[model samples]
Target chain A: MNVPLIARLAKKDVRVTVREPYFFFYLAFPLLMTLVITVALGSLGGSVPSLGVCQDDAAAAYLSSSGAVDVATYPSIEAVREAVASGDRDGGLMAGEYYVLLYAGDTTSSERAALYAAVSSALAAASGSTETVDISVERLEPRGLSLQVRLIPFLVIIAAVVGGLIISSSLIEEREHHTLDALFVSPATPFDVIAAKALFGLFLGMVLGLLILGLNGALTSALVVVFLFFGVLFTIGIGLMAGVVMNSMTDLIARMKLFNIVLQFPALVILFPQIPSWLGMLFPTHYFIAPIISLTQEGAALGDVWWKLVVLVLCDAAVLVMAAKVLRRRMSGMLHLPSL
Target chain B: MTVDNPYKVRNTYVTGYSGSAHVMMIEATGLTYRYGDFVAVDDISFSVAEGEILGFLGPNGAGKSTTVKMLTGQLVPARGVATVLGTDVSRHPKAVHERIGVCFEEKNLYPRMTVRENLQFFADLFDRSVDVDELIRKVDLEKWASERAEALSKGMQQRVMVARALVNDPDVLFLDEPTSGLDPVSAEQIREIIRAEKTRGKTVFLTTHNMAEADALSDRVAFINEGRIVALDTPENLKLRLGRRLLRVRTRAGDDFAEEVLPLDDDATPDRMGALLRAGGIATVHTLEATLEEVFIQLTGRKL
Candidate 1:
């Protein structure tokens, strides 16, 4: 294994990929999905609501001290209204002739309720009324992640797995262009090419995966990184297999989309309560993100998902082994990959 | 270009075949290959000496490429030995690869990379220090060095492929259809480069169906058909033995010209042609030898 040769090949591939029109588009896939999820779940904010107040020092001081709601003091009542309308604050409270509670046009019903509660409580507590309604909130179904947090795994997969998709497409393009023949006849070995593609895919996927996770505010402990690695490995196998098996770019894309649809069943099962949980286990990637989802979102201990971690490894190994067999068989006639 | 023998065949006058004092660069002994039941390359033998161009001429699917594949160690011969550069090809393919350069018929270059970058990438692969600018200039790609390969015309791209083959300055070069599809000027330019490489003392194995190219470029030509070598010798010999056997003469027979076809190699040719000259007026005489294609057809009963 010539390390420099592999690095050179991988570096060329990265540069080539950057030149491809799809590079920016592929990189934007994670960002696009993140934006969609954020906008859809932004109104469902369970984090402390922020409110702007002006000419109402008592309410602002009370809200700030309450620790349940966040308060931002504005210079004037008009400033509070503008802040609320621009979505800088969730809602606003202002004192003109009388106290007024404001709501933005785009505020969801949930935000409206929170704004009403914040205003009422701040005004009541500010007036020295110690006795007030103590509301206790409980969920009918406990131990479930918010819809926004629940979709982070999906976004991470999208962000990281683009690398594998790029690898597979790059392989097919190489074949069509006959660059493989050029490389094989040179001092470079088939293994050098294969190793280069795999290495590039791993690095690309890892970077995008970490970036997406960070953007989503998902926890990135050692365990999450390990699971992300497994996820990327599984994707690389699928990507290489698809690239090797398909002869044309159109066919590769068609098949990859179908594969992606099937891979998303686990995400669907995790998101929708109506779907059966056991169904997601039928797919190999289910094991890949199951433990990570629990660790990052649910704060579950390792022992709780230890078996899942083992299953993830086994699944990754199985897919990677199958990919190797397929790759070797396909390249045998034209070239041969080195023993990894 | 004005040199009578522009091909610069170093050992053309050497009567002994494949044993010129010059080192043998490529030797295939009874080489044979099969694709399942189909015999792509039957038992064949040939050798090329250093600084010589051996044009393996044949039509598509005539085993020209198959033989090259074996000699290049891309395919294992079923029952023969392919010795290139004094080493068995199959046993030490890597060594052979390091020492030999090849330009495939297909212009397989990095489409997104510039001409200089493409050459640079291969130089890095060989792990040899190559002057990128010099290599680009070798292929006449200096003007297009910074232009992406895809942006260049097919002729320019093929030039880059040729340049890539010269990156390592290997002992032997396997050029498979170096100028398959190109304008006359571009093809001539490529041929000029091949001629230059020959002058630089590089052995070249050229494979193409274009007999004119074979006649113009090869020091020796091998006519391959049906996975077998029909004839292997200098083009002059092949043309003399098989071609130029027929002659057409026109003579006046009392104001009405009569035509007579004469076989130069036929025994009755002297009596038939002499009698015509004795009778007095010979109006016109036209004679030309058969082309390499016609010779190949005559030898193999098939056209290349």
Candidate 2:
């Protein structure tokens, strides 16, 4: 409500966040990893099968004896020959010499073998017709999905969201360095400090999220973007709670590890089950990934996930209220020390 | 030193309290603070007059910080009352906080903000914007105005902390070992700033274990030991009160012969010092008196 106080706090938050090398690494490294993975491993669907097909009758008959490969017959020799050279099949079998054709960029053994099997089957079906039929076929399975496309973006989003983790660490770090006590003595309230930190961390999470979305073209749903904003708020609130509850930096770190195991790891379970309705309603970031992919891949409207959005917003409010209470108690002399 | 001018410290005769009379700024009666079953400050009662610098001297864990925390309304008193600036501290801490400035013993500057921003942040807290340039010059931090707090040396940061304490220009300033962990020169700078605040007629409640600091700045020193006020008086009065008879004086002569021992409280006995000086053989005429530290030891039977 007090603009100047909030502004000063905001300035302080920015300075503290930027000054730490770890915060920067936490903020920047994930996006970089996502970019590297996307560039290095994206679009790698098909690689290889080592099998080969021959245009000769004997080879074609041997392959046709097995029903493993599909072969198509061409009407004319010229048509068959063109199909073979054009990589419609891995190899073409004529009277004797088998010509194995490779796509310009095609490599890896499995791809070549699949192609040969198809062509050999087609030639065997032709069965030495003086009509000079030529055909080739290869059954090569393209990779299910590129590792970068499928997992990198998901990992990046999860990693980037953990900027809130660093916010909690910074709060504890300030306490260890003795700054939090000075803040307590100032006229500022614990609410003011907590709000400042949460807002500061929220801004960082947003920036990192935006960068990944922009680079990968993965974030598409405007509704999902709104979901993400609230998700960030919840994460920041959780971080503040962690910071306020812990007595020291070491305790905070240990507690954070426990939180990661208990709270964050469960999101892994949530991901595999088609995102159960109960989970979608409960976990604030439940729609965080689904909406992103839906928007990017399906061009789906974020309005479809509006309920998830509402749930996340509520989660943010609840967690933030809890965090504010803990912070106030910590700032005050609520923690009992044994009388010495 | 004896002054020809009559404006120096004098014993004022007063009979009753009146409107024009100076009132106590901080008054604690039977103040006791405990954590669970342990009492940190035990029934300590004392009062500080308006525009007074009350030295709260105690060694580590002597309940000095705990007492200060109660007085400043940071910690609720376990038993008894702490009235700061006429408001019950525990009952209305917000009011107390609004009126007082606190510079704690901890090195608690926001390491991310610049020197100027740290001061400005405090200034904004008081509902008034400060001239950043003027504040910088006052703290002698003009050279590092834009440098982040983390970049400055520890002494420099302490100076910045002092500046922050004065930003609100509060009525009462609570300094807990303000100059601790600082070099002598920087410690002197902090002292100078504190003295300047006192000159502005602000009440200063300072806590420290440093005897020289207490002796140099305190209007009245309260020696706290084991959560009790062992002795409370002006530095000179404490010294005079304890060193009753023995007045040891050193003169620039042979080691044994230069020492003059005289009775202090019994002026009626003889003017031995005047006679020695009138004899014209003494190089320097002086009186030996107990320091605040010596007096504290005498009263509390413990070293500060």
Candidate 3:
């Protein structure tokens, strides 16, 4: 572990990966997936939260045009209250003597967030003030959550998956292009090259995972951030191991399809809680996403799920060790491994 | 097409005290390597003297690359020792690597990186300051320095590979088919760089199947086939020892030309030539020497 040499080699790998057109193509999956999902969640949500506006044409027109929710015109503030009270609409806003808002307790936080944005923007426009619009709220019940939040864990984990894939591509291209031979023949030992590859995978995976977290408004928590870090390591370890099994771009792409099925299997299993938790835990990605679901959805603290983090670290160590061994052997004239 | 008289073999040595005696930079004794049950390098013994080029010539799979790999410490010989720069390659591959360079037969440059970036990356690996522009200039590729390696023509890429090998300014260079597939001008450019390396007192171990390349660049040519060194000597000596120089005689035969060949090395050639001239109707006379390929065939009894 020559730090300077490792740093230099890692820097070179990063440069080569960024320069490859496929890196952007490779990264676009999670980015575009996140972008589309987030945008869709913001506008359409799980379903549009309808709001009733009474005697406030400005707020009604503004909310309707905002597209965050459907705004129905009510004849009076009494009608708006009845609509929100019955849960036919998510919330209500009216301008009679004062600006008032009525809320439904059954709406999830994301749905309420969309309603809040639409109501605030509509109220601010109606009052002709950029300052925060003050309004009184009346809730029919209380607050809760639903299935929409589950998508957040999936988005963040997919970003880590892409990060790992970048590592696999860099490793495969080096062997396929025979640049690995060039590296070894030059003063680089197998440890130097493989370590550099692992470092690059970690760096890329962290960046992507952080981006997904930022998009989901999940970066503020230290626990989620730590879990995300180890989660990335877990996936990156898999990515490095994937490189050991691949030599050509076509082969990597082909196997990547299978890897996708394996990586997503655990996430998809979450849809059916009736399936045994141990069965889902059998996959290493479970160590990653389960902690995420616990921390984000269930509000579990570090003490509650610290064991999963340790499991993640162990899994990363095992995968990295296996990846390093096979990759080193592959570079050492193991023609059966990667003769390309 | 031979420009170098005996091809810079005997003079590169240091017997007359112009400098320190040129030591053998590469030596292999009874080196053997096997791929499972098949032998790839078999009991090969050869040495490359300092500042000299030894062309290891063979056909497609004649153990040339395997022998070089053993010498460079990439592959450990199954049977004997490969000493590079007075250190055993298997024992001190890193020690040997810090002072040697190798250009593989495959085009292994990073495709997405610019030529300068590719060269600079390799140069960084050696921990030595390399003037990449000078190397790029040496291969006549100053224009393509900013161009990605994959964007260059095949010859230019080969030149980049050559320049990359020179980045370390190694004392001994092992080039495996640098100009394997190139236009004549590009191939000649690589040959010129090789000549310049010898002039600068750098030992080169060139391996190729092209007999002309072997003849033009090698100080001593070693013919390898079926994992063995069949013949090893200066090209002229090898040709002279196993074969003969001949004269091609042509005479006017109606609308066609009748040709007869005479061995120049044989006795009574002058009488035979004089009698042929006296008989008249001579059209053309040309002298031909046995090529290195012909010498290889004479020794191994197999065409390369």
The candidate that achieves the highest lDDT relative to the unseen native structure: 1
CA shift of A76, model 1, Å: 31
DockQ of each: 0.35, 0.30, 0.36
Clashes of each: 0, 21, 0
Per-residue lDDT tens digits for candidate 3, residues A191-236, read 7887787788777778888887666655546777788888888777
Docking class of 2: acceptable
Q: What is the alpha-carbon RMSD of candidate 3 to the true structure?
A: 7.6
- Model 3 spans with C-alpha error above 4 angstroms: A43-145, A271-278, A333-340, B1-21, B245-267, B270-288
Candidate 1 lDDT over residue span A1-340, tens digit each: 9999899999899889899887888888888887777767663235666778875467788788876667889998889877876768767777655667775543433444666777778777877877663333211223355677668767777765697898898999899898988888888877789889989989999989887776665544788888888889888888888878888888887887877877777877777857888998998777777777777655467788888888888988988899988888887754432222
- Candidate 3 lDDT over B43-110, as tens digits, reads 87777889989898998889999988888887888988999899998887778988998998989999
Positional deviation of residue A313's Cα in model 2 after best superposition, in angstroms: 4.9
lDDT of 1 at A95: 66
Estimate the overall C-alpha local distance difference test score of candidate 1. Answer: 0.80
The chain A TM-scores for the candidates, taken one by one, are: 0.71, 0.61, 0.69
Specify the poorest-scoring 10-residue window by lDDT in model 3 chain A.
Answer: A331-340
Q: Is candidate 1 or candidate 3 better by TM-score?
A: 1
- Each prediction's TM-score versus the true structure: 0.80, 0.72, 0.79
| TM-score computed on alpha carbons, candidate 1 | 0.80
